[model samples]
Target: MTEPAAYLPVLQTGRWFAHLPPDFAQPLLAMAHLRQLAPGEVLFLRGDAPCGLYAVVRGAINISGTGGRADEARAAMLTRLEPPHWFGEISVFDNSARTHDAHAAEASTLLQIPHEPLQAWLTAHPQHWHALALLLTDKLRTAFVAIEELALLPAGQRLARRLVMMAEGYGQWTAEGQSRRVIGISQEQLSLMLAISRQTTNQILKDLEARALVRVHRGEVEILDLAALRATCY
Candidate 1:
């Protein structure tokens, strides 16, 4: 595959590739193949054989589980991954089938590194294992925090925290110094991620809007006052 000029630059921005030495990082970049997805396209499904690790180069991808249903649209979304994020590491490490479905939340670009090459690289450069471990640990810590929030936090607080996290995860400022913390997600998707009823989520969002903490639109939510939103997390 012809390497896109943007490939290396984009990979460098990701936490997954940030700590890699040039020797190891260069070879891994060479082995990656670019993959593109249209909106709502399925990248992989639960129970599907693991293909490789994926890094989101641009746009968003949704990770979800079926909740014992056949239709994917009905699946409960776990999270949305923006650029500079890597996933599918769990299945790659265990050599097991994919545990969740990954779909394009919008038109997306990805770099897929096949399992064999990744395994070989890891084996050859065992010292680099620490960086990979750090990546996995970060994911685990996020999961643990989610579990703690679900078990202990009230619904409104959980919603507040989720929005704040999303803004931090995916938001960016433009050169004009404008805080463009607009999240490209609908209320329904937020409800699924938080595991809350749509009605309850809508009410919470309406309350935030009333307080000038957020501005909700069709398929998007913009953070109006990030400091105030963070204050709600308590």
Candidate 2:
């Protein structure tokens, strides 16, 4: 794989990587190689042994699975992660098999920093492991927020909040000034992320559309009003 000269900004602008001390950040960036995937390609599967870290460079990654608990789309699918989002770290930290499936939601480009080299680098600079821990905690907080929403919110509210989160890139993207007017997710993927059925998703989206909060398009949802979308969350 060739070095992606154009992809560094996507990583550099993200909170986690941007804050890393130069000594730690420079070498890691140098070691990364590109992994390209065709649409629908499986990047890794549940139970697959740890491989490495991945950062979305161009397209989206469909993250799904239930750790052998359930296979239904609602129960299985997690979130769709887009550019600037880095994943595949839990296994690298714990040396466990992958806990979920990561597939290419579309033709995608990922930056892969292999496990062996990364582990060696961390061992030599143990303090930098805290950096990785920060990454984990960032995700943990997002997961906790999602769990709380699922427990206390209605389906429509939950869906609204999820959209807001995606548009915000769960905090990984807000700094980049990325155009988020349109969220590039299909209805099926959106429904799965919310653990709701397609019919319900469509109906709720239509309800939002009727209210002029959003404009639904083919395979995408345009936010007619970001403030309104955030307001709907609460």
Q: Itemize residue pairs with steric clashes in candidate 2.
A: none
Tens digits of lDDT, candidate 1, 1-234: 546446777666554576677786777687788899999999999899879888888899999986653563465889999877788888767889999989999999998989888888888888876776766788888889999999999999999998887877632211222233898989999999998999999999999999999999999999999989999999
Indicate which candidate wins on lDDT: 2
TM-score of each: 0.90, 0.93
RMSD versus native structure for model 2:
2.1
Please give the lDDT score at residue 58 for candidate 2: 88
Q: Write the per-residue lDDT of candidate 2 for residues 1-234, one digit (tens) a residue.
A: 357656878888788888989998887888788899999999999899888998998899988976433554335578888888899889979999999999998999999999889998889889998989999999999999989988999999999988888887888863654547889887888888888899999999999999998999998999888888889887
lDDT at 52, model 2: 92
lDDT of 2: 0.86
Give each model's whole-structure lDDT: 0.83, 0.86
